[model samples]
Target: MGQVITFGEVLMRISPRGKKKFIQSNVVEFFFGGTELNVGVSIANFGGNVKHIGVVSEDFIGDTAISYINKFGVDTSSIGRSKRPLGVYFFEVGAVMRPSTISYNRSHSSFSEIKPDMVNWDEALIDGEWLHWTGITPALSQGSFDVLKEGLQKAREKGLTVSADPTYRRGLWQYGKDPKEALSELLHYSTIFIGGINEINEILGTEYSYSNEDFIRASKQLMQAFPSIEKVFDKIRTSLNSSWHKIRARMWNGKKFHETKDLDITHIVDRVGTGDAFAAGLIYGLRRFDDCKAMEFGSAACALKHTYEGDVNLTTVSEVTTILEGDISGRLNR
Candidate 1:
């Protein structure tokens, strides 16, 4: 089995205890999470050897972040320490009919200030068969973008399969550069992309309506523009309330489109890292199953992530396979 290597930031996520509002909370909970790092944890939990590469502050806060990811069995040897402080964010869990909210305090963090030389691509990527990243890294700063571009170049030279999640956080892209320019250059080396049509429009400058036909048009446009991309996928979500969501997913594998059935989730424990969970599942499925089965397994992982509290999806392959097989009975096993 080959190793999956993820490149991105690891943030210190602070949440209010329980369903309390941020202002009303007396206690807080902290965890380490970020786009690529979250996917790394999910793949590791599924029994895959994964390596996470990012910078951490030379402080205890950074130490804690490293320990958190390490707990999930992800290799942290490439996560270096620096003088800048670790990035952090605060979010409040919302119940039915109320929407969740997030506030970030991540500027000037170690990972954001990272340079291309900071990450030794040749050493960090040794024995790495898959490389995963997200748009969030490029949105951080020019320095982060440069590092990502260099890393992606090296990953391509090494003949590794590259996957990316275009997580376009509006507020994170205030670094005075157009996201399209930065992302397009890096995505030229990507083989798999996970994001919605809106994200594709924002980053690729293509007009795509939320219709099924338009999705195909957009996917074709994307693949044409970037010949390196072989597959484009997205999870279609219908939120009935803060607690209930119905999710299905679709993927365009250059030659055809494959979709999954709706996985209704009426009780969402946490929805923070569901997309990353889906990305991990898709990567896992692509290696072991066909496109249709991969979409089903990936969507099942997304649905199951809603029942977990933290950013990392701790569900196993057997558990996800059970859900994919229509065994969402939630019954106990002896």
Candidate 2:
């Protein structure tokens, strides 16, 4: 298989240990992750060839972050450096009835300084078969949006499949550009839509409810609006509480609509990056299995991510397959 190229920021995530509020705990834990980086790392752990392109601080912190990604076997050669501190976010992990909260401090970080000229799209897309991008990257700054647009254009010219996950955050789009306009332009270059009805409604400025029927309608409207989008995949989550949640996946691949059984996660260790795991699983699966099986793989991967603590899903292909085979008992293996 050719390489999967992921482009976005690399962030250092800090969290209080074990559901403790910031005021209740003096200790914190840190992990390296970003939306696209998490997807790239998970795919790499699945034994797929993956490369991540982003910017980090030109310091030891950046060195450590690169080491973390390198240990996962993701190619980091395309990553660049700048004379700014690495972006950092503080995540307060909640449990039971409490909801998790995140605060970002990435306004002047190195990734926000990225420019289209810094990335040699020809070199990055040379061996790439798929390119993955998220709305967060473009929401950072105009420069990031331009760079991502340029990369998407290059990927299109090279005939590489482009996956767009418009993980929209109203707060992130502090730049003057309209979120709908920016995301709409990027969606034009993407072939796979890794989001749901809410996202589609947000981009298209429509009122689509959460019903499955509305989901199908919204997806069809989305495909009609953006002819480049061939498939739509969504990970539906039903949260019982911050710690207990259920996940399932549904997809409309032009011809048929498929949905998977809900994978109940009674205890969630960390909820961050689960969506990225689903995206990674789908990308890996679509290249190997049929559409229905691929959606199942994505949902299984997403369910397994809750068992890990960090921002990236560390589960291997065998582990995910075990879950897919109906083995969520957490049984001992000798």
Q: In candidate 1, what are the lDDT values of residues 1-334, reduced to their tens digit? A: 7899998988988998888897897899987899899898998988889999999999989888888888988999999899999999899999999999998888989898888778899999888999998989999999889988998999999999999887787788998988888788888989998988997898777788988788988999888888999999999999999999999999888889877889999999999999999999988888788988887888999899999988889899999989977898999999
Q: What TM-score does candidate 2 reach?
A: 0.99
Give lDDT per model, in order.
Answer: 0.89, 0.94
**lDDT tens readout by residue for model 2, 1-334:** 8999999999999988988889999999999999999999999999999999999999999999999999988888999999999999999988899899999999999999899899999998899999999999999999999999999999999999999999999999998999999999999999999998889999999999988888889999999999999999999999999989999999998889889999999989999999999999999999999999999999999999999999999999999999999998998999
RMSD of 1: 1.1
* Candidate 1 stretches greater than 4 Å from native: none
Tell me the lDDT of candidate 2. Answer: 0.94
lDDT of 1: 0.89
Error of 1 at 152 (Å): 0.6
